[model samples]
Target: MSRIGKQPVALPDGVTASVSGQTIEVKGPKATKSFTATDDVTLEVQDGVVVVTPRGKSKRARQQWGMTRTIVANLVHGAKDVFKKELEIRGVGYRAQMQGNTLKLNLGYSHDVDFDVPEGVTVTAPKPTELVVEGTDKQLVGQVAANIRDWRRPEPYKGKGIRYKGEYIFQKEGKKK
Candidate 1:
């Protein structure tokens, strides 16, 4: 049995969930999100809660049980509130600023990197070195932050580059005799 699947996801006040076949849709004040579970798992909304159960005793079914439950929980949470990811830019002259819907990054490159902000997600630069990504969809918010960080991943030698807030980059010794 899956411990996580055993626990139903509660629907908070102002949040509602509905199930149709294998798909579950959650609606809240912030947003409405829907997810379709695989055939190995079943989705149901009952008594102000969402429940997920496996259709069979197979290993795949067992695996999908927990995964499906978590997905449903994420949908509910995302519908009710926004998800956020923060990034930090380290190194001299490296900075970021928002230009309309685009994020302009200066990561020590000869030319500035222009990142087009996709719909449904908002990228804000509170400071030159700080960036905050927010969206109703958790995956999209995290992916946008990762893409921004990929332009200048921290190097072990100088530990200078774009990185997630609180992320530690393991440093290596410099050239020695």
Candidate 2:
């Protein structure tokens, strides 16, 4: 039994949802997002709530039951509000800034790194060492933050690199004589 799949997703005020075949579309003030569920699960909207149920008792159907529900819920949330991810540069010379539509990064490299901002997502650097990635889609926002962090992941010794805000790095002891 999938407990999570049984719970219905409620549509908040100013948010609306529609069902067309296997696809569900959620419309809100900020944006509209749609999701197409696999045949293993059934999607329906009833009395302003979205429901998901597995078509059969097979393993694959059960595996998709909960996942389908979560995806539908994410679409509802994404349409209503923006997902944000914050990144902090820990290195001494590492920093980032927005130049028009591009994000200029200085991660102690010989040449500066530039990242192009994608549509529906906004990358802003209020401070040189701080970055905020905002977008309607949670997946895109997280992916952008991960790509930025991948440039220079924090090391254990000095903890020098880019990392998510409030994330802790396990420091290792330096070489001893």
Candidate 3:
């Protein structure tokens, strides 16, 4: 049995979850999110809580049990709260700024890199070196942050690049004289 899957997801005071067929829809004050489980798992809402169970004893069914439960829990939580990510740009000339819905990046490149913000996600630059990504959906927020970091990953030589706040870059020693 799955330990996490055994636990039902509790609905918040203002949140309500309804299951139709294999799809579970959760609505809260902030947003509404839904998830459709595979045939390997079954989902239901009972007594103000959402429960997930495996449809069979197979390995795939067992794996989907816990995974589906977590996804449902996330939906309930994310519906009411916003997920956030912080990024720090490191380099002498590297910086970031927002122009309307676009993110202008100067990552020591020949030309500036412009990233168009996607729907359902908000990207902000409080300081030239600091970036904040926020959204109701966790996956979209994280993906936006990752996409920005990929523009200029931290280098081992000088550790100059865009990286998550509090992230440590392993520095390498310089070549011998």
Task: State which candidate has the highest TM-score.
Answer: 2
List model 1 lDDT by residue over 101-176, tens digit each: 9999998878999999999999999999999999999889989999998999999999999999999999999999
Could you tell me every candidate's TM-score relative to the true structure?
A: 0.97, 0.98, 0.96
Which lDDT values do the candidates have, in the order given? 0.92, 0.92, 0.94
Could you give candidate 2's per-residue lDDT for residues 23-112 as a string of tens digits?
Answer: 888999999998889999999889989999999999999989999998888888888888999999988878899999999999999999
| lDDT (C-alpha) at residue 134 in model 1 | 96
Give the winner by lDDT: 2 or 3. Answer: 3
How well does candidate 2 match the true structure in TM-score terms?
0.98
- Runs in model 2 deviating more than 4 A are none
Show pairs that collide, candidate 3. none
Using lDDT, rank the candidates from best to worst.
Answer: 3, 1, 2
Q: Using lDDT as the measure, which candidate wins?
A: 3
Tens-place lDDT per residue, model 3, 26-114, is: 99998999889999998988899998999989999999999999999889888878889999999999999999999999999999999
